[model samples]
Target: MMLNANLWWHDVDVVRRPPLEGDTDADIVIVGAGYTGLWTAYYLRKLDPTRNVLVVEAGHAGWGASGRNGGWCSAELPVGIGTLASKYGRSQALAMRQAGREAVNEIGRVIAEEDIECGWRKDGTIWLARNEPQRARLMAKLAEEREYDIGEGPTPVDPADLAVPGLLAAAHTPHCAALHPAKLAVGLAGAAVRHGVRIVEETRALEVRPGMVLTDRGQITARVVVQATEAYSGLLPGQIRRVLPLTSRVIATEPIPDALWRHIGWPGRATMSDQSLMFPYLQRTSDNRLVIGGRSIGYRYGAVPRTNHRDDERAWEVLEREIPTMFPALADIPISHRWSGVLGVHRDWQPRVTYDLATGLASAGGYVGDGVALSNLAGRTLAALITGTDSPANRLCWVGPPGRRWEPEPLPYLAIQAITALTALVDTRESRTGGSTGLAARLMGIAGK
Candidate 1:
């Protein structure tokens, strides 16, 4: 199997849309036709059919992280609820949580209304704790959620029922769903078109100016310009330090037989992950294949973003080893695919949706690795702000002025490397000692806040 080929694109044949010809004009010109841009375009047209919305893409729609992610349409935010409360306020934090849960349902509703068969399932998520240290962390998290009176926070599940080996404890949250990411991206693009939004594929957006977007094909003048180029934001001029691009890799196994599934039971098909600092996330695909991903390849020097990382042998090796360790029943299963994608991470690790009415500029991203569900919310908020629609989404915590830009090059590169190394070290130490690493708490404070 090709390491760079996305598993989700295995059976889907994608036809590129016509690129923009010469100069053009639109009510909204959005750069990068990933989830954020496409959703924004979809909502813009839905909210006001008269508005001319144009989305220019470097490649086919969803070619970025949107199509290549872990297939988790989860309500999990890049920052935790407690983190949000401390930074904003308790009510605002709760609202953000509610928005996330609502976003999950909103996506499902859109998928159904569009009749897009993308293997959508609302089976929820299960987070396992394989060691005592990890269990402690999960317990503490549950305690915090209860203290805040968060709605139906994760509840404990018996490890024996999950069938995963060495699971000391498990917590399941009903706020997530697993689906084919590429299918959703392609579906959204089709939906946007049906809603009268113009999308130009294979047209690279060179730069986003105040009221215009300069592309490789030509210039597009618009009343409002949006930069929706998540991880690739660093590649744009004047946005080199805006968001650090962190690489995460994935490996998918061949379909597991029914007999093997009995030994590794996840009949609910819920997305699963462990509580380790540098853990892996897994999901049972609609086709019965087990897809596991994580073990970040860290950030590249100069914050450069690329489509392929064929040199990520170490990360791939780690993931390959992880599958068998987690589910011994899959020890003989062959990994059918391997791929990597970059996700945007803000300095404070909080995603944002910002619109500046003065410059007619709007942006949304920095989702870390949680863009699937959050992007939908961001798109609605962006549309509301652009179309002057009175929506509560416009008041979410993520809708505001952009946060601080990441520190210049070498600094961010070094910091990411240090953090990655510390994460691995903490997990390894905890696994060996079966005790909490006091440093884990401090590391979370630094990495998250």
Candidate 2:
């Protein structure tokens, strides 16, 4: 079957579910079939065997960002240590980081226990510094990690180790792993079904209220309703600003030859990236393909898509240009796939979990571009809160904040466009001049505060 959204699904066989027909009533209702919804459904069944759970999806499972991501299940939270420390105190901030690391391992544990066939490798990730500004930025992050003992912070690696050109220094951390994203998503959906959770696909949820969800098919009334629609949450009534849908584009190259692999010398297959404002993330597929993603190449005006295609030519051009610049040795490699997907971005760019006991409404998202692992973390937290388990994951610092919505229409659109343009300009200027440009530093300062 031809993959609808991503290269990761090209060879995998997905089991499809028919759309919901007629009105349905359940004990728990989820509004999205992506990772968050499926994971929540899965855990709810595991926690309470008698609860009637139903999941509704706009497209197939994994059709959203869950299927089209960089595939680095990194141990990084959406928020940084210092920011978390300032907001929730230092100990809670440290506990948040520890929970993130556990979540990463938990993904592996669950995949193995469930016998999911996703290609998973615990090879870790590396951030390369190709310029002085990038090197300084990398070191600044490292200094903070070292100061706080925040797990295995980036370690310095030699330029020769990466076999890439113009590498000043490199930072390596074992806190990340590479996986086939679509496989994990589809696997989770299948696993949830096997555990007695009902999932309905191709069912668009128009509105999600406290105890009911209005869908294209029909209405679903349940005791508890979860608005798990990450990027598409804007489409719902009264949630246009809960999260902004920012487009992230990616391209995958044909399998490289063994001789080229010898030159690349990435036996560990570490997910790689460079330090740039508009930086790219890299992953080597199990089938030996190269997949890379560029950040926020296109922004949806008013948090909505302008076209159905969603793919941007400028973003594709950036991938083509950056790949050769990073590795001249692989300049001859051909791009096999080009696809784009949008991810949710909070105004503060922090991932959060919100649940109201009185309303029986809950949500977990706003992961920015780091949702792959953070989504799993959000799933566990949402499950605990819904079931009244009183677990540590539910009480974490990220769960307390009632995230402010985005600015009104024209303002959000304008702000996103200006930030994207400014960041691109900053990256360009920093690449040319090795001096201490305060562009990224200033942006970081403002964002953290």
Candidate 3:
């Protein structure tokens, strides 16, 4: 049940403490000490080092997807601006969007400034195409990128140029990056401690009544409470409804040959993914292993560990079969480690920051799978929102909640399952057919609804 790096954010040491045994007070109280909460403290201390900030976690720090994720520090390409603009507004969307891009830069800056060695990479992202429709979409998307002003070439990389098999094309993006996730988390926790932020692990926030957060062994009073729990937002009131969770799985191949690395010309050995709705993502570790994973939408977010455990064969099955399909030279590599984590897929697939100014209670969630970059950006932004600072965090486009209600169609859980199954079935099947899923596939994309 411990959510440490038994997954692939690589290894790191997290400080563990027993539950709070009594009362505490701080200027800020952050719940769920993953990437989001920790960054909240890290930045808060940066802006005002003298203030007391308490970070409480249900588990160890970064033990959630922050520790277990694929380690790709990417921008908000996964979610379209249409989603962004609709929820928050053009300026806010642009700011939120820019913040995600800045998040990666901030990470590198943090590592260098603080000298935290987290295997950070500034290479880029390559999204492979399984079939021609996917390839054509990339070609179109690359062209589309110019229109959206996502900077330079999201252009297609010919499969022939790499002498790889199976893949027809890959949209190579030079702006993205990767990192050793858990290492960054532990380092930040250490860094935050240096700045007077108090972090307590294994301390669950049992209840929140405006200024006081009650836990089993202790309670902390604050003028403002920020809930940074991304995956397990269900623990907080009204949070679970904001983000619809999808359990995504990842597996690392034992390590490919140096020959393969040379072929890919992975500049800084960047992170990569595919365009499939069930996105197949791959990135090279500092040690040369290729870690890849895709979505099995049929599985609920919470069941990833149990449903896709290493021995179940699907872990290796998905990676082995899918990795080489994206990069055929990697077709023979064996898997060494495998893990899964639940990601909060915010409705409309946009990252949202919501706070009731009257209540001074805020919750940040719904990064979809863009938590690595978006979460950090959101954490800092949430802190600024709470402190009433004019920091760039709030300038980002995604600054508020969905500000809507979930009109549950038929039932809650059952409807979600059926939609997931249908979407996966149609998406995977259409992917095999090689082009866009057409109108039928488009409609099925909402099967969960």
Top model number, lDDT: 1
User: Which parts of model 1 have CA positions greater than 4 angstroms off?
Assistant: 1-4, 307-311
Please tell me which predicted candidate would have the highest TM-score against the true structure. Answer: 1
Ranking 1 against 3 by lDDT, winner: 1
TM-score of 1: 0.97
Q: Model 2 Cα displacement at 419 (Å)?
A: 1.2
Candidate 2 lowest-lDDT run of ten:
305-314
Clash statistics: count for each candidate:
0, 0, 10
Instruction: Give the Cα RMSD of candidate 3.
Output: 3.6
Location of the lowest summed lDDT over 10 successive residues in candidate 1: 305-314
Candidate 2 local lDDT, 1-449, one digit each (tens): 21224688788887789999979899999989888898899899888878999999988999888988888888876667888888889988888888878878989999999999788987888888889998888887788888768656667777887678778988788888899999999999999999999999999988888899989999999979988888888888988788888888888888888678678757667899887877899999888888989854576666784323534667777888888788887898988888888888788878888888998898888887778788888888888888888798887888864588888879987876777888888888877776557678876665572
Give TM-scores for every candidate, taking all chains together and pairing residue i with residue i: 0.97, 0.96, 0.88
Sorted on TM-score, highest at the top, how do the candidates line up?
Answer: 1, 2, 3
Model 3 lDDT, full chain set: 0.69
> What are the clashing pairs of model 1?
none
Q: What is the lDDT of residue 322 in candidate 3?
A: 67
